[model samples]
Target chain A: MAEIVLEGITKRYPDGALAVQDFNLTIADGEFVILVGPSGCGKSTTLNMIAGLEDITEGTLRIDGQVVNDRAPKDRDIAMVFQSYALYPHMNVRDNMGFALRLAKADKAVINAKVEEAARILDLTQHLDRKPANLSGGQRQRVAMGRAIVRDPKAFLMDEPLSNLDAKLRVQMRTQIAALQRRLGTTTVYVTHDQVEAMTLGDRVVVMRGGVVQQVGTPQELYDEPVNLFVAGFIGSPGMNFLAATLEQGSLRTSLGDLPLEDRVRRRLEGRDVPRDLIVGIRPEDFEDAALVDERHTGHTCSATVDVRESVGSDVYVHFTEEGGPAGTAELAELAADSGRADTGMQGHRIVARLSPATRAAEGSPLDLWLDASRIHVFDPATGINLTHPER
Target chain B: MMSHRNRTLTGWGVVNVLVVLYALFPVWWIVALSFKDPSTLSDGNFVPRKWTWENYHGIFQTSEFTRALINSIGIAVIATTIAVVLGTMAAYAVARLRFPGKRLLIGMSLLIAMFPPISLVSPLFNIERVLGIFDTWVGLIIPYMTFSLPLAIYTLSAFFREIPWDLEKAAKVDGATPWQAFRLVIAPLAAPGVFTTGILVFIFCWNDFLFAISLTSTTAARTVPAAIAFFTGSSQFQQPTGSIAAAAVVITVPIVIFVLLFQRRIVAGLTAGAVKG
Candidate 1:
């Protein structure tokens, strides 16, 4: 119902540590925007600043085109669903949902009717009279949502609302939240560290790292054209594989093999100061079993010893080790540390390739893999910037 | 052979009986003393040989005992109410706020709680007299509040810490003002702790004999415990044991009633549903 505009919003703590710096984002009316990053990336702090729970040390916050830097959370007309649910323990589900209306001094009948409608929408009608202690985790989550829905506020701010639920329930509730937002058409700003939630639930996703935004684009755009090494490694499952490579003449000299650059990449690198030492990025799905590849499609091919083969019903993922060392850079090291794989002392550069189910690749066996050279991304070792997609 | 579980049960049963006997024996003696006739008061029997309501009747007939009882109730009630209100605010600030002297405030309260009351009795006596509040309800109530405020703050702050901080933010986001959030959301959730603290403060104020006797000399502000020491018989040569026992029983009834009324609420885990485990 309203567009939330955060213009250079910054949050600097009293200890002089900057939690968020110059954050700027204009959430369009009825658009679902997700702020996603690893832990300590200031995603929640940014959301809190918008909710007025945290003071913005710099810049102005505008809601519906009015500056509300000093307005309280209640005066801002925004509803938030916390990660902990935070349902009032003393009140029953009905009263918890109708609290805002009651606080506004609405008529009793109107409060009851609106609460009933929200309960119906959330499928919590049977639990309206039950205390929060009596309901299941999913039911409590619904009550949290119903509390926000009954207000029909200017926007909804959700901070990892599904994190408390189990994995299966999280997926189920994620779909429900997406559908609910679409049906209500209410502007929502969701903050989460789970990139999958960011990919699936948002019209546009903002990938952040170290309190700075890396990229903001649609899910497909982010997946296909990540602007930096962090976003490329963070966006997709099984993450993009980073390999140490060197660019010389018109090809990339990698540990797997020398890969001839595609015409488009060669054209993009025509007049730029291309670094000799580069980090080559390739998504797992971009690799194929050479035997299953189309005959007419010409692509780079490499032979690797398959260390592990996993069959997940529809496709097979083959993990292997290359002779080259890991593509070590500050950004990739941070990404590895964030994923808890930093000190693993991995033997060699690990590579994962998604292959067709029909391919007969076995563990400890040699297999020929085809790489889609045109989909490959090259990053500068010094700056972590995706050299091929720098304009994105 | 007896089963191990049966033996354990029997052992616990014996221990429970012994504990109950150890706790209730003195209370039984007091009740028996209150019911004894003045002529048989010195018999020292566990049970009263000739039971009578004479001691109760005698104490009630005198306005001195009745006035002292009224004063005890009023002072304890007022002190507990004021102390709890102030303590709840201070505890909330201690639990939630980040101020400069927060640690110092907590330390000071703890220090006051541990301070010996007898050492301050003479100083308080002089201060109260100079302030023109000596021998009055305000004098006793002030000391009672000052001592019990630390107990209230410590107990209530522990309870406040158990409550999730997100609830307050949720309340604000739900369109409640700061005062409304504390009143409606935080206070209700903190009721068990508040009630428990109130009971403790009341009992502390009720049973305090040192201050009660040292601060007040006349019937105007004398509480039951203080007045009990001044009780006399019909003759100066006779002792007032039966009357004193009766007054003690009368004062003990309110404490028992308070515990019985709030026992369930004090034990209830009210924060169960506030957040996920």
Candidate 2:
């Protein structure tokens, strides 16, 4: 097994196009690290650089403490599962899996044993004689994995290997892959645009934007403490809502109301000389129906007029207008800076709140809202970076 | 409804009949002439008074026809083989490799194909003289590649490109070298294109008459086309008609037989990935 380390790794095209920059990460042996980003956000480019498919423009890449900057993919002792699976159309499943071993000139018995092992792991024993074209999408994906597995490579480089599968199959394969990787304990670097997959599969996830590393941490860490507005908006399902708020004396003020700071949060913001205006991050689930807001967290409650209500069986989400945040904040850019929020003192125009299933909040109703202030994330409106705990 | 449909069917029937006649008339005439006696051939009618195999027997008895037949087959096979191999490599590179002038290389190869063989025959003749192979099979094979290479590469390259890159990458991860990956993954996928190219190149090489006649002056190196000219030579035939028709039948028979035997390969995917065949 290999512990892959990328130090200041960057890729720049001949036309001065930057695909990835200063990408530093150390994936431990047996760890599954995921590179997550939107399309063209350099996740694939980074994966390709690691796979030796693309040439790196700067920095060093090491596998197991050996600098592999000039090494070929084969010499790197790595196996890659391509997004397309890349199964040989003419070869049967067994031959496909055995291709690498056979290329290594392993004994026939060894090849057969390993091929059968990989096939059994993938539950592909019965289909060993079938060609790739005859296989289903999931089967093809398994064969790709099996091809990588049979090699017993130092690490597994998966380039969105499940992107081609249908939704339900993708989830099923996703878990199966994670379980398989856990069993094998091989170092794996999986690249994908799906945040859910990254969150669920990666031991430590790296969030990227514009070819730059945004944050690298556990999914929970990113979700609870996003370093910037980009990570805050990017990590969660519905994403954290950003509203312009004032860093008043011992409290933050929005058009909705003054949310009194909790002890822990107050301590984080106490010594910092933050600008008067700031971008406050509140997760959708942190906002509950104000009518249902218990006295325990009433200090953080704000009143809002509901606009849209969606019932999703287990929970209800209410989109509403608040009285004290930025007025008509639509673009992500307007909330990126403290100074640019022209209507910061007017009202928070739009808000999405997750209410308890028992509480019903209808459109046109002016309902009191409560925040789980202990979970409230404060970011600088100017830079979109969280300012409440700037040190960390 | 039955009557209207019957009328439509009859119209199609007439059109098909006209097309079939247009296609088969010349072939039927050739075959009929081949069976004709010298007297009947000179009479110049559709049907022969009597059939004879004497003209066919004459072709076997003569050394000129036998030598030309072997020479033609040898030249066609060699040219087709060379064309297929070179074309496949060129096509694979253009299809998959990311070299600086990849597109330009493909474009130039195809652009050079637009130069007619007849136009290049004189220059090739000079080259042939320099190489001391003016009347040999090598000379014909060399010039024939100029015609068939472009088509072969064009056919096989597109097919190679159509194969997903995943298989090759999978091969690489499987520990196969790039060359091995190509052999194991790309070759099989490109088989149909190679087969199609072989058949087409063979047909073109076999039917080539211009360079064959102009370059090769002797019976030892002359192809069937040039050899057949002897049957109609001024001094040889009394009327020069029946023997020429007989030689024509000899020439057409092998091509028909070869096409029928391997019709599947040519038809299965000759223009499978072609935008317009």
Candidate 3:
């Protein structure tokens, strides 16, 4: 219903804790925008600020080019679905859905018509007479959705609304919500902690951390070209493995062996002050199963022992420890849990490689890996910024 | 197979029944006395010498017990009305709004409740004398509120907290002002709590004896508790047995009916509103 723009939006509590700082994002009308981060990352705080639930510490929030920072939440023409549902327990589905219209003093026929239409949309027609206590978790969540839909507000704000449901229901509702948003074509701002939800739901996802926007782009942009190590690791599942080694004698070498970098990437890595702690990042799928003793392969490779291997029918996961590959200081904070990972390989200097079900390997066995050089992410070990080779 | 724990449980159950019997004995006596013949009111046996309706007749037909019961109802109704409105408004503010010195205000309300109210009777009498409203329904209603408001405000405030903030925000987004949200969303969700609070205030206001006795010198403001105490004169030491018994029955029956009607929600509301599971 409206395009929303957040210009230098920030939230600073009275105690001087900045929940969000200098946040800027542009969400087009009829687009689904997701704010995502770990707990205490201020993703939800930012969403609340946009909904008029929290005061903006600085900057302006505009919907349809109208500054709405000082406006009350109701005047902003938004509807929200809460994580807990928060349905009125005393009212039946009909009353719950129609409550806003009734308060607006809409005619009885208009309220009834709107409630019925929303119920039909949500498959809740038969539950019109039932109170929230009588409904199942998924049903109650739908009722919360119905309350918002009936209002036909300018924007829909959802704060992890599916988080409380069981895993299966969460998935089902996630799809339903995305589909509903598409059908309604309302400008929506959603805050979720789950990256998968963010990737799947967002037209433009804003990845936030430490009360700051890390990157704002389409999911494809983030997955393909993350601006920093944090975004690269946080946006992908079984994240990109970050390894440390050094550039020596115009080539990259680790205790494992010397690895060939693309001429273009090599030129970038060998630039001024050659990186002492060069971090090599490769996707799990990018690490192809190979034999260290293979006779033919010569171009691209990294080495780690096969610590543990798991199979999930469709694909096999080989988690291995990097012997002399890159391990020391190349990892991001989330990846730091894998430091010194040599024992169980569950959390340590380990790399998880996705293999075909046909490949087989046992735990604790040393194995060789071939990297798809085109997909490898090379970064400055200290700055964590990607060493992008425009030619490559 | 019975274990040692089962034997202990059975022993505890027996003791619990005995405790319950001790609690019910006085109530059972009052009901029995109300049905006994007026001539046998002083009889010794727990069972009346003859069960007759004559004593009930004496109270219902002769005395002003009915008038006194109506007067008590009127005063309790007025007191509960004033207390519920003020207490709920103040509690909502305390629970949801952030005003300066709110915690201190809440502390003062609790302090008012903690002091024994008997100390305030004379001061209240003086205030009433100055206001020229003593011995009236207004005087009785005023005194009862002091006992009811604190509990109502505290209970209602706790109830307000359990209503998830999302609901209010949703109401706000739906084009309702903050006041409208409180009236529509909060008031409905908190209705059960309000009922529970009302029942508590009603019971306290109805049973208060001191203020009802000292403040009102006439039948116009004398409540059931005060009226019951007047059944005997100091010099004669003679109790109006039938009238007092009949009045007790009238007073307790409504309470029992109320409990029966709202037993489930009231229990749930109390536990939910009080931070209990």
In candidate 3, position A334 carries an lDDT of 43
What DockQ would you assign to candidate 1? 0.89
Question: In model 1, which runs have C-alpha deviations exceeding 4 angstroms?
Answer: A343-346, A390-392, B1-9
Please give, for residues A264-291, the per-residue lDDT of candidate 2 as tens digits: 6777876776778877888999877667
Residue A267, candidate 2: how far off, in angstroms?
Answer: 2.0
Regarding TM-score, does 1 or 3 come out ahead? 1
**Model 3 clash pairs?**
A74-B172, A244-A326, A338-A348, A341-A348, A341-A349
Candidate 2 lDDT at A282 equals 87
Q: Across residues B1-277, which tens digit of lDDT does each residue of candidate 3 receive?
A: 5788899999999999999999999998998888777678888567877888765566567345667788889989889989999999999999999999999989988998998888998998999999998999988887788778989999999888877776787678777888888887788778778888888888898888888899988787788888888775223765678668877888998888877887677666421211101
User: Candidate 1's error at B151, in angstroms?
Assistant: 1.1
**Per-residue lDDT of candidate 3, residues A301-354 (tens digit):** 655678789998888899876655455443365434422233344434667788
Candidate 3, CAPRI quality class derived from DockQ: acceptable
Fnat for model 2? Answer: 0.48
- Residue-by-residue lDDT tens digits, candidate 1, A1-392: 79999999888999999888888899999999999999999999999988999998999999999999999999999999999999999999999999999999999999999999999999999999999999999999999999999999999999999999999999999999999999999999999999999999999999988888889999999998898899999999999999999987778999889888987677766677788999999999989999888852556998999999999979999999988888998888889888877788777778999988998999999999999898899888898888888483
Best by DockQ: 1
